[model samples]
Target: MAGVDPDDCCRGAHAAAQRGEFTQATVWDACRTGIRDAIESQLDDEQASPVIIDGLPTIGKTQHATDIAFGLDVPAAILTHRYETRDEHLNLAAEHQKTVAEIPTLDRDCPTRRGDHGSGWAERINDYRSRGASPTYLHYYLQDALPCMQDGDCPYLARWDAVEGADVVIGGPAHAALDRVVDDRVVIFDEDPGTAFRTEFDANQLSTAISTFLRRNDDLPVDNHFGLIGAATNESMDAIRDAIRDELSDNISIASPREAVDDDDGHAEAPTAVLAMLELGGPIIGDTAPAEYDWDDQLREEAGLDYVELPDGSQVVYDHAESRIIIRRPPDLTDSRAVVGLDGTPVEELWRGRLGVDDIESWRILCDDCRARYLRDVIGYTFVQTTSHVKPYSSGEYVNRRADFGLIEAVENRHETAPGVITTKSAAERLFEESPSEPFIDIQRVTNRIADVKHYGALRSSNDFTGTEVGIVLGSPHPGDRPLQITAALEGYTAVRDDEGKGTDLDYGIPDRPFLRHYREHKIAQAVLRFGRTTAATVYIHTGVLPEWLAEMVTAGPETVMIDERSEGQRGVIRALLDEAPGTAAEIAKRERVSIGEKQTRDWLKRLRSEGYVSRDDSQPYTWAADGLADAPHTARVRLPDLE
Candidate 1:
């Protein structure tokens, strides 16, 4: 097993390919030796430790893990962070001739769907939840009543039985944690399961649940001093806990109001905070602070609680303007069970110190030279950098304007293949909302070539945009200072706050380069890499926040031309014509097949020439070409007309 050869895997894969079987031989051939050696080294150690295989994207990490879990010949579980990746693993495991079972969460399922929770379950739940319907009853129906008393079979629970019988199990991190499936078996985490460990509950949720519990459990001897806001003592928290425990024990079912319209704008959901509070054995208070978390003194005081020592070594903190309490604890991987993690960007301190994994080892399948060779020879990757303002909270007018200019430049330089656009969900939504507006409409030609558009959160472990040669990343996804401070605290880094006593609007507190890179630069990199580095692909990064490693590969792209006082329709036609090959105004207009007349196009071209957006040839049949001025543009704000 220690000598598990890449050549052997390649031979098997080649045989499979000849037989028309599913095979990713190229990836297995590249990194299987490193993976095997890493596993072998870990196996020799007397004490069990988590082994993380750090490899670049599209290197078959998931597939290799699936194969290793299958070879272990035990009831194994593969945990994934994203739904797309989880689904991908399920399919990948099945293809590898492994009996796999999937456990799906009931978060998106309809509560009243007695049977298998058929299609449209998500829509049904969302529709009701959106219309201000109480989710407390829905939780009761789905969790308690339906599973225990319903006539039809419950797919969610039924899958567990299948999981017990299967050789391999595939599911999300949350499911694995809840089911205790990580114990006594080989568990492979496909990505960082931070979301599973980070428990968050808003103050409004606790307040609503407290009010609901008191009103419903009037018979119980519960005190009314459990106020979540303002200065509160431990005694008040105990009263809140007692009330919640009673409510849970009674198992009283509440009917969801069909037409309940509360103007509070809060979901009338279950007593999630109440239940979690009870689970934490009270109001998230403990005697000793945990060593794994760096609790901000001010933040803890604001939340009315600090990092409390628990039996499981978990810690709690408060964050965001919403006043949410967050509890973080690493998933238990004890009892000498083999634990392997798969991640491209492994934050060692985050895993070891913060997540409470004391003894852990990491192995990179591809070194710098190896990865560079892969990128150069196999990927043929080209990087294009831009200076656009892609931050979500930045000025809408400026961000949109810069984004349009950058995208237009990238599109002009791109090959014939369709492009992929990656941005924040808000920016993606704004594309549609402001399609008729100036800057957005100006990038219509670029938008039309977009084969796909994905947000930051959904970019990881996705293959949807692999075929796209050109990828345009709008911005870097920054988690802000509060999260950065929490991460810094967890990873044993000093969080330097400003003299204003404010963590908000501060960027330089956490000096740890890796944490900063992980939270900021890695997001943009992940989005760009989704287009896959295998084969020739040109990536256009629109923001300044990029990693040094990625920045080294940056090449010059076309200049973003800025035009002032240009109408939407006329500007769109001019930009479209500019992006096209060199031709006369009529020729370019005909090539675009736009409704704008040739004369109108020429007039707009002349205006753009005066505005330094384009340059006209001195020939009889004048050729209009974009100037591609990469400098500051005219700042005159003017209202533009809509496209006809």
Candidate 2:
């Protein structure tokens, strides 16, 4: 779009028409003006306010973003995860495209399919040599600029000559970091975690005498006391933690911010000293970490201070995003230009808080029911398998070296089969080399039936299977992994347990032995929100183990293949209780329909009683009763002293 005009969208519509884009007669949906006005007001300000487009994922947020660029008659640089997202960038990027030769870079290797490798690779090599820099050398020497750099006109920063003229700039955080962005250019961060940056510290640096002692001794370590804090007591957690420690110790500072948070916070639900040493690059420097994240909470856990020593077997969780909010808003990447954030999660408060800008304009645009509709399109299983979190017990004596942990399978396998299964990385590892299960085989058949679409990767993670009929997540990765489930973490997806008896929000126990409990609840739901991105998702729970995490069909949306929880012979007992009269434990045991002896009857009755199907009398001779049961039996195992 060229030549701004008084009529808000006049020039934009014209340009889009000329370009044969944004042709929708009613391109702007219900919230168009709210967003349009926000952008315009920002532009009018001597200093533009960063806009946050907030709503559920897969709604028209992206469309609205594109419309804003068009409505304002400004060129846009769109940043997105997939190639298909290119269309979202304002028509400006298309105008900015340059042949490979046009991109100024120290890299002279003009890789081409049309080439003689010897001559092709060599010609570019010489071009790089002539520039007084090797292809490997960053021309502007921008490799070392901080997030708050003030260096001007570094060829390395603006080397993408195209970006200089580009109306808007789009790309990942790396693109956002480049000095190419100018005061006039508007920047948009499409996802959360926005554009903050962190550097890494060495994990080994965090090691101390206390941590080393805890490693070999039997004092029963405190939550965050040693380097092993948050690790499963078992060999699995210990092994992974040690390996991570090694990886951290070996770091030579590979360049650039990683896809996930590389520092402390990314290692698990929150930052630990080890992860802080390995991943958190700063000092967190001058920028305050997100307020939602409680730094002190983590500290208290590390010191085992401020915690009550509880009775044994109580659950204790150090602070995490769930119990309390830790604010992670980083300092502004730029002070001079406009920056906008687009998000699908319904968290205006969270995003605005993260932006930490007093004047950031946040609006909640209505989301469509497109997500629910997608749910109706698929059906699948949500397997609930249990794994052990065992660590060798260590007293003053020798340690038991045995560690048993069983979890799900690889990223690809969990994704490839099923109407879209949700599993953990650990679970995926279990199935990594195995063939699809019987149900999984059927899922594959269904997926394969779609000739033009595949339901493998993105479909399973979301309620909106926009491009395919189904979506499956290769199970959500454990928080301990480096990818940093940002969407999940942002939605307060941090796991919680009550076993530690502490007042903390996070479990400093072994990280992944849960391969189940911690993962299933938050992982699936978040996968649905971020869908392809792993924010939230869930499958029906079919287990005798944990039914609380199970959900009704259409977990993500309306579509579902819900299999009821397996009865496992509990139904017969339930049926027997339908209208039975109060009876002695022995009488109940002899009922022909019960089909079980006294021992079996006791177990079944206990199960039924706990679930509310049966009630036991507390009188003289206690008896069990349900709908058909008569008044309480005179047979209590012992009469409660008749209360006066």
Candidate 3:
């Protein structure tokens, strides 16, 4: 297995995620042996059993997959040609499929040469009826065996040469990888292990299918597609599921019972006829994962009558609440083909049950002591809500100010890594391996304090920071609820769900609260990686949940460590103290146009006095001034106080 370059590993993972695409072998050089061996075992095994290694990111699973793909060049064919060519071909002409295309070239660290390219691949695949055209049936499915990040690099049918042994195929995520699984081959799942069983249903397509079917003859409620029978909303998925199941059973005769059930017959059951008609419609409109024992499967003569159990232990149904749902049955590991998956986190029992595995192979080789980091610091900051009586603490101007103050205080004492505000694009770019710098921040430069965040942000933009001088990176959870948004990108959530994260059979809206917690885990993890790698990176997290790993790492966990005391607004208040008349807290709040009450201002004034930032003047109602400015307090203003 390849070792991580201490300096590059953190940024490499970030870069890998942030970059335009992942194709370079260099981006996947850091790896773990457990992952490598697991994949190799699956490939070498005669029994095609799936394998999964649960571990964390930055531990080198992607690197191992990349290495295996480039190093081992073997070939296998899922569909083959038969000489009897006349008799009938057991080819897959139609069983429903996703988009996949063949390319003639290879680049970005592929390690095999294409020889003996298979024949007949160029033939059009007849959806489920492909075998109808015998002789050339499925002969085109042959491919050269080379481990690749994507199937694009798999050796193609050069001359239809016979391949030996079990085939190993790889992809960027579980969905992509699952597509290439063929008979008698090991399916290596080193990417997106968390998504092994997520099922995405297309609601829009379901609506269309039901809509078109109801147009001809309505045996049931026609409005809104049989009323609640075909509604596309999350809550309606379960009800619609029952409606469809009952309809299929009512119309038992194979070919749609000759004609539609007469509407005038008052056949009050759901339009079983309409549901059957939908099967003939575009498969795109209504889809499910694990190939349910539905009209579609029966229509194709797939010879299966089973429903996959979902992760929640509930029998698989049209579950509407989850945007992505896992189901009971294991994927078709044709011929017992092996599949290996690796991750840092423990494997879920839901997946284990699906894979027919009882125990998860778990281990780790990373820690604060690992040489890959200089300081494995994990900080937890608890902050009080930064809201005044007038407005909620939202991701707007007020929150930005609160964030700036917290972040400044967190990193103020450290003169190590350069400090600046890092947006998602830059953070992922700086961290993921695939994302490389065009021109980026100078990590070595240290600033006294970061101010004017918007302007500082503009200066660090692409080609904006042209100076050789250093740059800054402001730290913490970003102002908005962005951490959770980025969390969706982690485990194939974005692949199956719509922009709103709704699935065909599920709604992901429930995770909004949990996503906030998950996102904080990432924040703390990133803080440990990007900042703790070189110095004791201090992260001030005001919102979202903290990662359990980091929460336990630090003793004084992050609480409402309000740094509101050292802000420009407070500085303005200090400046207001320069009033020649030496006014009270109400007078100061009025001068600054601040909505913060006089009591809050007076409390701050007193706090500033105790911190030696301001001195009280011998006047009525006792006003404050910058230290040593009591005498000339009326005319001259001094610098804002700094953290000692």
Best by TM-score: 1
Judged by lDDT relative to the true structure, which candidate is superior, 1 or 2? 1
lDDT of 1 by residue, 80-160 (tens): 877777777777776667677776455533344432445465555555555335344344445544432265544545455
- For candidate 1, report its TM-score: 0.68
lDDT of 2 by residue, 2-116 (tens): 1233343443233344456532222234235445655566667757657776544444455566555544455444455433454344443344442111223323222211133
What ranges in model 2 sit over 4 Å off?
A: 1-28, 44-49, 73-77, 81-84, 87-137, 140-159, 193-196, 202-298, 302-337, 346-361, 367-429, 435-465, 471-644
Top candidate on lDDT is 1
Worst 10 residues of 2 by lDDT: 399-408
Q: Which whole-number lDDT from 0 to 100 does residue 449 have in model 3? A: 45
Estimated TM-score for each candidate: 0.68, 0.42, 0.44
Candidate 3: deviation at residue 90, Å? 35
Ranking by lDDT: 1, 2, 3
